[model samples]
Target: MAWGESGELFAINGDDLLTLSLEDQTVETRASDLKKDSPQHLPFSGANILFDIAVGPDGTAFVAYYGNRQLLAVSPAGVVSVLVQSESPWSPHGVDVWGDYVYFLESTVGGRPRWKFWGKDRIAPRVRRVSVGTSTLETIYDGL
Candidate 1:
């Protein structure tokens, strides 16, 4: 979640988007349930699992969804719209706004197993970046 103009808190549920009034602690729906009816299939399949949000210079809030690598833009009026979609199974985990760019991190794996018997890395396997306005994506970094 992130703060909007004047410190208004906003959150994305991956299924429904919402905004909160910090003064009164009121909750409002920004975007309702989104249905993916696309016939063209993708490797990833699931509702949005929004993990982080960042407000841009224009006061627009961008939400990063970990499940489908979907980024959503929330307008001042609480309207949520699709900003970008990863071409593969990349999971978005964190987000922040840097000047004219909305920067975010996408991971290849969700999380690491706790026990040694699982034999999994205790962190995300990989990450990438994308330009907010232009929708240009690039692999900035990666690791196991």
Candidate 2:
């Protein structure tokens, strides 16, 4: 979960994004069924999980999807759009914003069963940083 600029907290559940208002102690849907809402007509089929969220300074939400290898944005107005997506096996997880960049982690071993048993040398996980507006991705670290 991540907190917005206005102090609203956002979270991803299954394939849905929800908001919690601390003042009112209420929960509401920010975006529903990401598969249907994903950009480029790429419907999120199967048990695709909406993994993590990062709320921008303007109250927009950035979400990471492990199965889809995608990063998505939810405007404060609740418009959902894909910020980044790939056909490769770059399974993205754990997202957050720092200044002008959105940072996330990736593991090639992801989406595979019993990945925990895989050798570290075989599974090269990475940390990536990207521009929020331009979506220019950079690999900051790999493995360990």
Best by TM-score: 2
What does candidate 2's lDDT look like per residue over 21-132, in tens digits? 9999999998888754444423234426677888889888988877678888898878988777744556677789999998887766444342463354244477888898
User: Cα miss at 138, model 1 (Å)?
Assistant: 3.3
Candidate 2, residue 144: how far the Cα is off, in Å: 9.7
In every candidate, how many clashes are there?
1, 1
For model 1, the superposed segments whose C-alpha errors exceed 4 Å read 34-48, 110-125
For all predicted structures, in order, the TM-scores are 0.68, 0.78
lDDT for 78 (candidate 1): 64
Candidate maximizing lDDT: 2
Clashing pairs in 1: 14-48
- Assess each prediction's global lDDT (C-alpha) against the native: 0.64, 0.75
